[model samples]
Target: MTTTTDSPRWFKSSYSNNGGNCIEVAANIPGAVPVRDSKNPHGPALVFPADEWSSFVSAVRAGEFGNL
Candidate 1:
């Protein structure tokens, strides 16, 4: 697990409207997608397999979470 201190490039959704509840993701990391709260840049991040993250995003676009 790499730390965010390495300065992994993080980006939030362009649709994010400066809300305090958003999250940021660093997809540049090889083999992983690191996700952290946008409000807490220095906080611990949850790293997910890139493929899994893609699947999750797809599900979200597909409305799997339903009204979330």
Candidate 2:
């Protein structure tokens, strides 16, 4: 998992609202991205490579998950 040693400021998804079923992400973590469930801050974080994470974000922003 990525660490604060990389010094990334995690941000909750802007689409996150009162539902409380959202996720948070830390970007630019050198070679990886760290993501965690917003409701479980102390839980294990899932790590992804930078390029893969960017593609996921792009897919999300493009509404690829909307119909699914």
Best by lDDT: 1
Question: What is the TM-score of candidate 2?
Answer: 0.75
- Model 1 residue 5 lDDT? 33
lDDT of 2 by residue, 1-68 (tens): 65552466778867677598888898757878989888898788898988999998799889999963
List, residue by residue over 11-32, the lDDT tens digit for candidate 1. 9999899968999999788778
The estimated TM-scores of all candidates read 0.88, 0.75
Question: Could you report the Cα RMSD, in angstroms, for every candidate shown?
Answer: 3.3, 3.5
RMSD (CA, angstroms), candidate 2: 3.5
